[model samples]
Every structure is written in structure tokens, then in C-alpha cells.
Target: MREPADVAVVGTGVVGLAVAVELLHRGLDVTVVGPRTGAHQGQGTRAAGAMLSTFSELEPQHDAVRAGMETAERLAAHQAYPAWLERIEAMGGGTVQAPSGTWVLAPAGRRSCLDPIAAAARAAGHSVEEHDASSIPALRAPASSAGALWLPTESRVDSAALMEALSRAVEQQPRATWISQSATAVSAGTVACTEGETVRAREVVLAAGCGIPALLPECGRPLGVPPILAGRGVSARLAAPGVEVEQVVRTPNAEFACGAHLVPRTDGTLYLGGTNRLTLDADPAQAPSLDEVAVLASDAAALLDPRLGAASLLDTRTGLRPYTLDHLPLIGRTGDPSVLVATATYRCGVLLAPRLAQLVADEITAPGSLDAHPYRALRPMPAPRIDDVLADGAAQGLLEHLLQGGGHLPPAQQDEFAAFTALALRALLDEGSQAGAAVRRLWERAPVIEAVPALFALARRLEGVR
Candidate 1:
């Protein structure tokens, strides 16, 4: 038994730490649980490229409400980051090394994809400047490259440094307790850990990311929390001897992932990222595959610069990104008011941390503040329309295939292939659930097909209730 605290924050990833720090700053006694080694294989914080991209991450959403809510959250985080970073630094968290601005480029044939992205950014009041692909300094754009759009507001930080700073800030807080152990269970006001240790608190927040599903059943009461899957993303660091870029450069959002991107870090290294494979097993010890590494390298060379192929691969990292059925974050308190959840931010966890932390803290300090909030935990998650799913799946599937050397196909053949893909996706969705022939045939190739199981489950649950 341990002394009770005001709040017990489970999980030590970026969001967890951010929430703990926010609560502590508000004069609350906090006990932070979860391992601090920063070596968790699925930990998103440390393995992140840490892009503060509000506009660069945008993609067309089928659901208007979901899109509006997500845009609002992203804009709020973008606005809050400067002040939030200042406050963290004031707490001796160390200055974060974040390069300003980002360049979003489209491959030659894909130039049209940049239109909606640029339009969305401009609509959101962020400045978008057009630049000739060849004129972009330090970039060896392929001869067939389309133009580029420079978002002056987008930024990125050194993920490792940011984590160190957050951990240091929490450690130095007098009212904060850092428990370097995994939390096994949580009751209304108590959290149980390995070795039989427990910490009682007035409120318990489950920001465990992919670890949430395991602990949900152990809660003293049913949380009615939605299903969360692990989107395992593999990224690598490279030492490109003479290759240098002053800004973050990335492609627009791809099929089931944030397209390949390069972040120039303060340590004179480049971060190459953009692979996502959703899995049912959220194993923290999962290893990055050689195929993932090779694809990342190949993407960098083909999409950004040919010189990157020779860059020394400093290391590879794997992070499990938590995502819900509709691919939106779950924030705010659950059905059990004393229990709150703030996970499933997916690719935007790093970008949305500050805003999410503040939202969580506000709910704790002032109940009912978030009663009407759109992202309130335990909200009904209806299954997305099957037609929309098939269409999006086919589009993304074709894009993925084309990127992987299918671009060499003749125009007529490409159209035929697209039709085949659409039909294939429709057939897969008809098979029902993730374990069916759908997952077997398209799990690795098509990203959207991964959500079928959860969608079917949600639809069935909703139907039963009706």
C-alpha cells in the first residue's frame, strides 16, 4: 500500500507524462506509473519523429463531424505548443530542439494530391507557400517530382530530448511521484502494479496507449471504452554525411500511414519515417522487420533524394500507435467518472499531447467542463459505412501498389488494376471481420482492411443494443 495521491496517471509515454506534469503544475499530488527505461518497443514518444504538424497531416475525411473535431483539436494543439513548450522549459525541462516549418512534396504524377492539403491549410489560417521542387535547397528532387508546398508553421522536435526533458521535469516536481513500473490494474480510485504495489488516488487516468485494452477489463467498473488497435510504425535514423535540410520534409498522408518524411534533427542526423502496420497484438517487445527498414530507405531515396540510399543507417525504431475504430482519439472521462482515458491518438500523439493533457487536467480540476466535449470517452462508435470503407480502401490500396513500382504500368493497365482493386476490396468487406479471408489476403497490402474486424464488432454491438 502507498499513500494516496490526487491523481494516478498510468503509462509514461508522451501523453501520460504530459498529463501528469499538467496536473502537478495545477498543484495536485500525482503518482506516475509505468516503466521509465524509455526502451519499450511500442513506446510512441521516444520513437517518434515528434512533428508538430497541424496542417501537414490533414487528409480528406469521409465523416464531416469527425473531421471537424479532429481539425479543432489539431488547431488547438498547434496554438498551444509555443506556450506549453515555454512552460516545460521554465520547469527546467530543458529547451526543446524544434526546427520551424515543413515542406510537403508530391511525387510527379501525384501533384494533384497537394491541392486539398494546401487548401485545407489555408482554410485553417496557416500560410502555405508554393516552391519549385528544384529550387528547394538541400533537396535533390527526382526529375519527375511534382512541386512542393511550404508550411511555415509546421515544426518538429528531437523526440529523445523531449522525453528526457519531460521525465526530468516530472522527477524534479516535489508533489510528483514517479513509479517506474507497469500498472496492471485500476479500480475506481486505485491502481495496482506488478509486485502487488498499489497507489490510491482521487482520480485515475488511463493514458496507456496500446496498453489500455489489457487494463480495461481489470477496472473495478466497466468503462465502456472502445476498442483500440496498435498501429506499429517503423522508422529509422540516418547519418547522411553531406545531406542537410533545414526543414521537415514529408509527403502528404498516404494510404494507411503518414507518408514518408525526413526530419533534420539538432544532432546532425535525419529521421526517416512512414510505415504503419496495424496489429491485434500490442506486444511491446515486437521487433522491427528488415523489410520495413528496407522500404523506409527505399522510400527516402525515391521520394526525397537519391543520395539517402548511401546514408549510414544509424538505427531503427518501432512505435505502436493507438487508434480507435474511426481513427480519432478518445479523451475525457469514461462512464466511471473517477476513471478517465486519453489514448488512441495514433500518429498525432506527439502533436496533440499538450492539448490533450490540458483537456484531461481540466476535467479533473473542474468536473463537467468536458461533458459536452466531442471526444468524450465512452461515446458511441458507430461502424463507418461499408461503401465508404471500400472506396477508401481501394484508393489507398492502389496508391500503395503504384508507389511500389506499379507506376511503370501503362495507363490503361493502371485503370484496369484500379477496378480490380475496388472489386477485391468490396469482396473482402463482404467476407466480414478481421480473421476472415480479408485479413489473410489484404492485411499486409491494404491498410484500410485492418479495421474490418473492429468495425464489424462495433456494428454488431450497436445492433444488439438497438
Candidate 2:
């Protein structure tokens, strides 16, 4: 048994720590519960490039309203990050080293992909500049390179350093108590731990990322927490002595992944990231596959510099990014008034942490302040139309295939391949009926073969509704 506090925040990831720190700043007593070690393997914060990207993440969205709101939220968070980092540092979290600016590269024949990103950035009042691929220093542009865009506003932080700082900040706060154990169950005001310890508080926040689904049943009823799937990504750290870039170098979001990106860490090592495989459940013990690492290396070589392929592979990390069906975060109060859910941030957890923390604190201090907030945890998010799903699926699938060496084919063959992919997807949808439709929808959002279990669950749910 532990003394009741003002709040009990489950999970110690970026979001959980951010929320706890924010609440503590508001004069609240907090009990932070979560394991401090290997528990975070495959979790987003541990393996994230932590790009504070507002514009680079923008893509063409069929739902204008959703797109607009998402952009607004990301922009708000991007603006607040610097100040927020300053505050954390002041609390003894240590300084977070984040290099300024990012180069968004467009490979040959993919100029169309960069157009929408640049347009969205301009509409949001950010400056974007186009430059010849070869003009960028330290880049060994492939012969098929198209061009590049300079986004001065985008940047990336060393995720491991940031996480250490957050932990230090929370540990320094006298009003916060850190429990080094996994939370087995959570309810309105009580959280049961793995060791049979129960901590009670007036309010509870579930920020456990992919762990949310498991604890939801213990809440005694539905919390309106949306279905969360894991977007598993594999990233590698390379010690390429002669290969270096001053800033973040990445491609525009491609297929269901964030695309290949390189982030320079303070220690002279480079972070190479760009693979997304969605799954129904995340395995913390899962290791990165050789094939995945090979793709990352080849993509880095093709898109950024050839030296990356020869770079010494220092280590590889896996992160399971939690996402919803519609690919938006589920924040704010859930069906349980006393419990708020703030997971499913997908690819932008680190970028959006500070803003989301503020949002969570505001809701706690003043309920109904975010009643009209678009990402309310239990809000209705119907699936996109079947036709829209098929269209986007084919387009993204083709892009993914191309990025994975399919682009080597002749232009005419590439077009034929695109048509063939679209036809195959249509056939899959038609033959599998409702189940096929559900899988196709999930595939477009996260085109990974490992997503079949989640796809089936979605199919059954939709079937029940019908």
C-alpha cells in the first residue's frame, strides 16, 4: 500500500514522464509507476529519432478536418519544444542536444511526394527552400537523385539523452514518487502492480503506449480507449567515421513508414531509421532482423550517402509505435471521468510530448476545457470509405515497393507494376469480403504482413457492428 497522491501516471515513457512532470509543476502530488529498465525495449521513446518535425510529417489526407487539426497540434508542439526543453533542463534533466534544421530528400521520380509536404509547410507559415541534390554538402546523391528541400525548422534530439533527462527531472521532484515495477491493472483511482502493490490516487492517467490495451479490462468497463496497434520500427546506429551530416537528413513520409532518415547524435554516431511493421501486440524482447537492417543500410546509402552502406553497424534498436485506426493520437479524458488515456501518438510521440502534457494537465486542473478537442480518447472515428482505402492502399503500396528497389525497373515497367498492385489489392478486398476490406484499410495505414492479427480483430469488430 502507498499513500494516495493527486495522480497516478502509469508508464515511464516520454509521454508518461512529461505528464507527471507537468502535473507536479501544477502543485500536484504524483506517484509514477513503471519498470525502469528492459521494460522499455521496443517502445517508441527508446528507439525514436525524436525528430521535432511539424512539416516533414505532413502528407495528403482525405479527411480535411482531421488533417487540419493534426497539423495545428503538431505545429503547436513544435513551437513549444524549445521552451519546454529549457524547463526540463532547469529541473536537472540535463541538456538535450538537438541539432537544428533537416534536409528532406526526394529521390528520382518522387518529386510529386515532396510537393504536398512543401505546400503544407508554406500554408502553415513555415519557410521551405528547394535545392539541387548534389548541392547539399556531405551527401553522395545517387545517380537517380531528384532534388532536396531545406526545412530549417525541423530538428531531431538524441532520444536516449532526452529520456535520461526526463527521468532525472522526475526523480528530483520531491512531490513525485517513482515505483520501479510494471503496472498490471489500473482503475479509476488505483493501479495494481506486478508485485501485488496498489497505489491509489484521486486521478489516473494511462500513458502506457501499447500496454494500454492489456490494462483496459481491469478498469471494470470500457474507457473508450480506441483500438491501438503497434507500428514496429527498426533503426540502426552507425559509426561511419567519414560519413557525417550537420543536420537531419530524411525522405518525405513514404508508404506506411516515416521513410529513411539520418540523425546526427552528439557522440559522432549517426542514427539511421525507416522501417514500419504494424502488429496487434508488441514483443519487448523482439530483436531487429538482418533483412530489416539491410534495408535500412541500403536505403540510407541510396537516399543520403553511399558511405552509410559501409558504415560500421554499431547497434540496432526496435521501437513499437502505438497508433489508432485513423492514425491520430487519443488524448484527454476517456469514458471514466477520473481516468485519461494519452497513447496512440504513432510516429510523433517525442515531438508532441510537451504539448500533450500541457493538454493533460489542463484537463486535470479544469475539466471540460478540452471538451471540443478533436482527439478526445473516446471520440467516434469511423473508418474511411472502402473505395478511399483501396485507392490510398494501392498508391502507398506501390510507393513502398518502389522504395524497396522496385524503382530500378524501367519507367514503363514501373507503371505496369503499379497497375498490377492496385488490381491485386482489389482482388484481395473482393475475395475476403469484409475481412479483406478491414485488412486492406489497416494495410494502407501500416502496410506490414505482421499486421494480420490486428487486421482480423478489426474485421470481426466491423462485422459485429454491421
Candidate 3:
């Protein structure tokens, strides 16, 4: 292998790009490997609207609250957007007009959800105001929401534009390289890509979403160090039809879990999103059911005039968000000195990128600088029993396709399925007196449901059944 470059980021998604930019700015040679030449131009980040807020009208939690505070503070102190904007204009890239604040709206019935989040936000050192239905519309136009809370510090960015600008900015730096290829595996200090290139880096970061845990062998972490899983989100983008809301609007109780966010861009484009679909593969072009679109449209029309609805839908897309089994980001270095795990930021990837990048870069450059306890590579958690996993697969429809649809199993789910099938095959292969009984038990208990794809996957896992 060639001598190690300063750093090699295995994915050029938002987190990968952000870390590369931070490292390069700190005078490190960096190479970004991904299918795209641009940073953050991959799936989810490219489709996101870059809403930097701690509180959500739909669901508020401590992770986002803390992450949001850090992000807001950093953006304000570093003037991150201004620096990004300058680069955008220089590269003839577009701009996203960020309002001075953001608003979280609640439906009449779901007002109770606000109390916990609001209290948490206040404790986190942010000002939160509770407004009646009347004040909400006046605070920002098209305010038909039942109630609203204004966050003065929250900001939004044009995700695609920022990604493009970041790509250009990094390219302008002589030490930065963007490799257009997918990494096949990792060894010692080098990452092998499908393009017949092996890059040796002083340090390697596994920032590939959904694919993180699978690369554990190369990350120098345990095979299953991170038990994180992936969840899918789909979004739609539309042209802004002159209906301006001074802040990003989030509605709860809409058809989509978080309702829809209407973020008006500086260039008059409005981003309307989105929905959470838990399946493994969420292709962008997958058309959302009419039911989903209606919910988003209804939410947007309530916030703005119906004219905003007059705009045509520009694109529909989906992103696979890396969700930990416990729903927190996995950051910090592993026992392996050369490898780092930075996956499972889930929905907060964009909001938490700046600080996360800092934490990651620090861990890479100075692994001994901090206690790696919370983020250490050790997995104290035990792998759930294959029986329990099989039940979950049944619940998640891992076997339904084999029974009803005849669909193919997803590759990621195949591992868990293999474990399940091993148990069933063991029973069958045992050749004991009760082997027939085991088959009946498996059949009776492993039926697939309509919603869970994992069940169908589990059924297929019984590949060596006697």
C-alpha cells in the first residue's frame, strides 16, 4: 500500500465531506471516496433542507436538544453560513435564504407533546415562547396552526447548494482529493475501493450510512461493535410560489410523522417534506402514495396561501438514516487505533455535523486527548437471541414475501435471516426424534405480517431446511 495520506474518509456524504473539509482546513491531506465527486451530494444530505433546530413540533428529545444547541452556537460563532455563502457565489452556486428563526406548530389535540420538549429546550439554554393560535399566524404568515413556539436561533440552509459549495471549496484546496468510487473493504491503514484503487490513510473514518456496521472488520473495530440499523425517510421538493414564511414550519399530527417542513429558499424554492419509512432500501424515485402527498400539501396550505400549493412538484426522494438500536449517534474512536466509527446520527446528521466532525477529527488526531468511555468501541450490549430476532422478523414481515409476494430479500437483512435459518436448520438437521415437531413449531410461529419486511427475510433465512 502507498504511504498513508493524512486522512481518508470512506464516504463523501455530508458527514464525510464535513469532516474532510474540517481536516483539510486544519492542514491535513484528505481524500473523499464515494460514488459522487461532491461532498454531501449523496442520498439523504442532498435531499435535506438543512434545518438547524433543536426542537420539533412532532417529537422533542434530549439528543436533538443538545445537538441543536451546539450546532446553533457554532454556526453563530463561526459564521459558518457566511463563509459557505461566499464560496457558493464564487462558484456560481445558488443560495438558500434562512429566516431569522423557526416555528414548531402543534395541532389542537397534540398540545401535550410540547410540554416535555419545551421544558427540555428551556433547560438547554434556549428561549421558547408558547403562543396561542391567534399569535402564531401573525408571527409568521399563513399561520393557521393551532399553536406555535418560536425559536429565534434556529436557521436553515439549502442542502444541495451547501453541498455543492463545500465540494468546490474542498476542491480548491490543493491537498483535498475526491475519489469517485465505492469502498469495497478496509485493511490495516488502507481502504480498497471497487475502482481498483487502494488508499492508505494515517486514519480511516467509516462514515457510510446504513453500511457502517458492515465495515467493522476494516474499521479495526469488533465485527459488531456498532449494532446500529437504518431507517428510511422520503421527501418532496417544490418551487416556492411567493408564499413566504419567516421561519421553518413544523407541524405535528399530520399524516407524515413530523408533518411537513416548508423551508423557503433564497432562490424562491420551497422544500416540502417528508415521511419516515422503516424499510432498509428507500430509493429516491420511489413514488409516495397519494395519501402521503395529501398530508404534506394540507400542512403546507395551512401555513401558507393555497397559491403555494400552486407550484409544481420538482422532485421526490428518499434517504436512509442510520438509526442505532438505542437511537443515539455512535461517535469516538474504537480500541483499534487507526479506525473510527461515526455512524447513527439518524435524523440529526445535518444538525450535528459541525460538532460531530470536530469530535471525530479530534479523536483521529489526538486519540489520547479524551476519555473514550461513552463512545468507545466496546459493545457491552449482547446480541439478542436468534429466537427473539426471528419473532421480530415475523413481526416485521421478513417472511411474508416468501409466503405471499415472492419478493427478493434485502442483502442487509440476510445476515439476521441466516442466523434465524441456522436455528431452524439445526432443528431439522439434528435428525432427532423431535425434528418434525421443530418444523411445525417454526411454521406456526414464523408467519409474516404485511408491514415487516424482516419476516419475509427470516423465512428466506431457512435456506438449508431439511
Taken over the whole model, the C-alpha lDDT of each candidate is 0.79, 0.80, 0.59
Expressed as tens digits, the lDDT of each residue in 55-87 for candidate 2 is 787665435676678888999998898888998
Estimate the TM-score for candidate 3: 0.70
For candidate 1, the lDDT comes to 0.79
Over 1-466, each residue of candidate 3 has an lDDT whose tens digit, in order, gives 5556888888766777778777876789988877764333226787676787555533432255445544454444234545545544553444535556776766534466566557656765777888764554422434334566777766777777677766676677778777788888865578888879988887888788776655556433354455555455666778754555556776542221344577776666667874554554434345566755665565556543456567788876566776554455677666666767676676667766766677777777777643543444454544343455344443223332232211335756755665665455445434554444444454343221222333233444555563
Clashing pairs in 1: none
* lDDT pick, better of 1 and 3: 1
Each candidate: how many clashes? 0, 0, 14
Question: How does residue 236 of candidate 3 score in lDDT?
Answer: 74
TM-score of each: 0.90, 0.90, 0.70
Report the CA-based lDDT of candidate 3 relative to the real structure. Answer: 0.59
Q: Which scores higher on lDDT, 2 or 3?
A: 2
Query: Once superposed on the true structure, which residue ranges of model 2 sit more than 4 Å away at CA?
Result: 61-64, 218-221, 393-396, 410-416, 429-466
